[model samples]
Target: MPVQRPFNFSAGPATLPEPVLQQVAAEMLDWGGSGMSVMEMSHRGKEFISIYEQAEADLRELLAVPANFRILFMQGGGLGENAIVPLNLSRGGKVDVAVTGSWSRKSAAEARRYADVQVVAEGSGRNIPGSANTWSLRSDAAYVHVCTNETIDGVEFHELPRIDNGVPLVIDCSSHLLSRPIDWSRVGLAFGGAQKNIGPAGLTLVFVRDDLLGHALDICPSAFNYKTVADNQSMFNTPPTFAIYVAGLVFQWVKQFTYAGLQGLAAMEQRNIDKAALLYTTLDASSLYENRVEADCRSRMNVPFYLKDDALNERFLAEAKAAGLLQLKGHKSVGGMRASIYNAMPLEGVQALVNFLKEFEARHG
Candidate 1:
């Protein structure tokens, strides 16, 4: 039996649902009597295809993705997709990138390798100023990239920007996928790594509108080309079979989840909202801790905060770990504490963290 671990809050490769882990463990040796573990099975085999198809189907149902969109289960984390997005879509044309935080900054840099990348908007603080109308978007831009949620900075775009230029809007939603409903009407393409809100580290979920396909530059790798992957059902190269299977199980789990008389992803999103609200409320009320993100743009998934006295950082982390809260240390760039309450983190977990925070402050204050 895998050891039961405490509540984990690592940013990526974070904690997964206990039930999903249990299911993966149970099926590790023999997947439904196929006489082979999913890991051992060939990606071309029917077993893996069924797993891929079901995962895609269930995710489509859960998110209400339009039929015109192709959900490609590819290999490559968010970092790899940074270049792949530009390679497939840029077509050597200009691309607009909104740099709200580290991820978008990296995306812009990677795209510059393939296209004339422009920083349509960049943020120095917690949020960006000016409206979409003021952005100097290029008419020849292939697609506009936006990091829907800045995990390190705790900035989130609660609403997608409206661009007057007829450019496809691409979103890097790795940290906040499935935490809320996406406005598919505004998004032409959205890519997310599975580790955050979906499943394991190797799998990447890319939703590309049908029209966006087949625009790959000649320099684009055949393996990373969206049109090629879609044509072959994401099996052009052996897909991440095991990760896709686990993600399918997670999608099933999400579809069955309930909250406040709502069910499915809507319920999961509402619960995420409530959980973030509770933690933010506690942090804001406390005198010793401060969350720097703007109230209007606070992230519902990643909450980064600082102690009033930086001297207590180590003590805060050590005590948090001892109290069954793990990985509360923030990213090194930000230098504080970050609590990533993904879809797997229950309300009870947040409540426990909140309680520990209050007790720790009272004792040390």
Candidate 2:
């Protein structure tokens, strides 16, 4: 029998597939007969180049990204892209942002440093705009920004808002990048950090439309210039080779993932849907726990809940840790427990968590 690992619920720098971790461990010292660890290889070397190219191609295929979008592997996490985005795409013009939750609020604040940022649509701490038409987008705005999934607030946008104006849409999909299919028709740019669902930290993926490149402001660093990074295929500076390698393994793992007669990304999406539904159903039926986000806006990946009796918070987290469910602590800003069930978190893991939830609630309720 296979050994069971503790289920990690961290929001970022989160869990990866066990197979991917195994492959990384197996190849840590030497990769593919190159006699060199992936970490030791030069970014420009063919060994690493092949890894980079395959990672990009596999991600493109997995996400069904259009040919017009350029996938860039760069340093700095999602927050870096918050500034880098406005520098490249804002052009000092108006940027209309839909501030739905913590992450989008941060995105709006960051963009304000580089452009005239507007809160086009505002959400209560517990809810988000129901549709694209609800936003107050500007006709002349350079781009409209949204964070598809807010890890902190436990909210998500099932469908991206569409802008009939000429302006494009830029999204911070850091938390739920590969959990489901992205409707690319409504997105001009999408960015995410590898740590959440892809790979280790320090690698950020930026998918930008071809037309949006080459428009960086004069002050933008050459390394961060979207056109420059694209021109060099994400090697403007030394790319995160090890993270890319691990992410490529993840992509391969995702491709081979099978579930209920589904395959690849399709299977991953279905599994996620089922996992979220199971978890939410359990929470809904309980009197001891509550998830505050609106049913329609709740994130499938990040589920934040509270104990009816706040005094039980520490006891709950302690018992949860002893039960092998790690990182169940909530963000300090939001004092509650959060479980981030990202792509790599198997259904069995969620089931284990669900089992623990019922047991805990029964003992406490």
Top candidate (lDDT): 2
On residues 101-191, what C-alpha lDDT tens digit does candidate 2 reach at each position? 8888998999899899999888986888757676777899999998999999999988777778878999999999988899999999999
For candidate 1, write residues 252-287 as lDDT tens digits: 999999999999999999999999999999999999
Cα-based RMSD of the predictions, in order? 1.5, 0.9
- The per-prediction tally of clashing pairs is 0, 0
Predict model 1's lDDT versus the native: 0.91
How does model 1 score by TM-score?
Answer: 0.98
Candidate 1 runs further than 4 Å off: 1-4
What is the Cα-based lDDT of residue 364 in candidate 1?
82
In candidate 2, how many clashes are counted? Answer: 0
Error of 1 at 332 (Å): 0.9
Query: Would you estimate the TM-scores of all the predictions?
Result: 0.98, 0.98
